[model samples]
Target: MEGDVWMKGYFRKRGARWSFTLDIGRDEKTGKRKQKTVSGFSTKKEAQAAAADLIAKFEQGQYVEPSKVTVNEFLGDYMSVHYRSSVRPGTLERAEHMLKNHITPAFGHAMMKNLKPLHFQRFYAEKSEAGLSPGTIKGMHTFLVTAMEMAVTWELLPNNPARRAKPPKQQQHTISVWSHEESEMFLQHAKGVSSYYLIFLVALYTGMRKGEILGLRWDDIDFEAKTIYVNQSLTYSLKELRISEPKTKSSKRAILTPVHVLQELKKHRLRQKEIKLKLGTGYDNALAEKYVFTTSKGNFIYPQVLNKALVKLCKELELSPIRFHDLRHTHATMLLSLGVNPKIVSERLGHTSIVITLDTYSHVLPAMQEEMVTNLETAISKIQTVL
Candidate 1:
């Protein structure tokens, strides 16, 4: 009853207990008021002390509303208001899965206003220790920060909890391509066993992606011109084979086939004509989907089916197994070894720019350093002779 309250009768039932009651009515001039009544005490001194401490705490701004906001609520608001419209469908699906499976479980029940940097730090450390790969954890961290950033923009949080949270270090993995000898062996094997040896030759010579190889049609090739146009790619979507425009504008450029490869193309064309005549009128236009690579039934070749064949063939030839994609890598590697300019290789490979080509094939270009040294040595020798 410091201001306008009452102290009820004391009790000694428990070891030590104290409580106070309050009227808490506002002073008219001040218009400030509060009311709480708690009455249980073993001694008057203890009750007074306890009441004083309670009043002190209430005076300070140390208390917070438990139900202010939760991480779950914030996540919902973040996704619905910001992410759904901005990201692509595939990217959104990955984000949604990451949040639901990884993020929400770790921080869902936490009060948004009370979330701290230490909580995020501990969570990231524990995830790393649990054997989650750094790249995967980094992806989750990116999603969380992205969502919380939106929360800040919407005024739901004062600052991002993920600030200063360091992402895990990623391990560098080297990409491997076939050696010259291995490529030659594989080409010979393809020539002897696969009816589509020209397909393999074209891939080795042109550095086209597997999808691009499968998507090549008769109209895209000009026999007299010795040029192959790459304007579309084959992909499986909706459980059916479909042809779609190249993934990027840069991927639609034309490539000039080497004269040696042109000779092979002429032979392959004659073989195709023989096969078409043998099939007669039964060779329907639908059957002529004009695929450069296909099965005996003339059906569009699936990537998985081709990959299986490549693996089986490698095992039979006693060669170390390399992914079908490595065929393209082999092509790029050979061209760089031959001292072809990266700009020309980049255009042929349909990369967006030379920088991308150089970055991807940097390991293969270390010989260029020795070439530079040779040039420098020759210049120095010429200057010394003149002197």
Candidate 2:
């Protein structure tokens, strides 16, 4: 059975189920009729009530068409169109990987408009039960909040369900850094055997990020002034390696280098030149931006390759294996222990704020506190003798 225009929308009974259709007016450009149909009500009264609310929204200019776009497809569009320009390649890559492996498998097939806060709440609970870290869950929550906000703005959904959902509490892990003796042992052991010696030295001495070190060009290093310019980062994006700007405004800084580190840098440059001469025109290093570090084939080195190399070298030297990033932490920890000003350390590490540097390194700075106490007591004793 079917009925015409019950409460400004058509109604029909198909077998035991009731359905409704609303006229959404005509398309201006095409002068064509437009309509929307929603079905699966248990009673004719229920279909009638649902259509009335939809009509009210349509009149108020607050109505959005229920789209067939699945969460997976919409998110794909969102990342490519919205996130491509806003985020770096490495960030985009990780986000996409997380979406593919963790998120999409849960509710990607569901209709985008039908997503509810409960769906996401269950997702977090399930992920937590599966032993995922709270910080990681928090990251996923952040991504959903942003993506769904964009959906609301684009009128793909009327509101952001993710904004109402709660994720697990955030958790942080202790940062690890090398001791001075271990740093010396590694450097001494690596100097003789490792091809990545200069790279490791640059990380420990400059406190630069792995991406920053990999992205360095020879011209960025000023041998005379003993300075290193951090301009860009080497990152992977869309299946290709590329260089992008630094992580933040402060990350692009010029670090003053020690004479010894610069001396080793000069030796590294000479070696690069000799390799270029041997490769002749076959060298990709002949490019305008001459990279400070590269593979024997003259191609830029991948970041993961460097991580693997560091791990293998640590095992060979019989030292506790640490991430390549931990070397930068080692540099900051060592300097703080030597009575270097916190502000100076912050600037050298290219932290956006000095507070970040202080908070991050405070756990490893007990020696610095002891040294400060001793100096303060000595100064008070000297003043007392004068009095």
State the C-alpha lDDT per candidate: 0.76, 0.89
Colliding pairs, model 1: none
lDDT tens string, model 2, 1-387? 766666556898888999998778999999898888989999988988898888889889999776679999999899879887898887887898889889999999999979999999999999999999998899999999999999888889998999999999875567888899999899988899989998999899899999899999988988888999999999867888899999999998999998989999889878888878888888776752388888876888888888998898899988998999999999999999889999999999999999999889988578888888999999999999999
State the lDDT at 53 in candidate 2. 88
TM-score computed on alpha carbons, candidate 1: 0.64
lDDT of 1 at 160: 78
Give the clash total for candidate 2: 0
* The 10-residue segment with the lowest total lDDT in model 2: 280-289
Q: Give the per-residue lDDT digits (tens) of candidate 1, residues 335-363.
A: 88878888999999999989988988999
**Against the true structure, candidate 1 has what lDDT?**
0.76
Runs of candidate 1 exceeding 4 Å displacement: 1-130, 139-165, 223-225, 236-249, 263-284, 379-387
Lowest summed lDDT window (length 10), candidate 1:
4-13
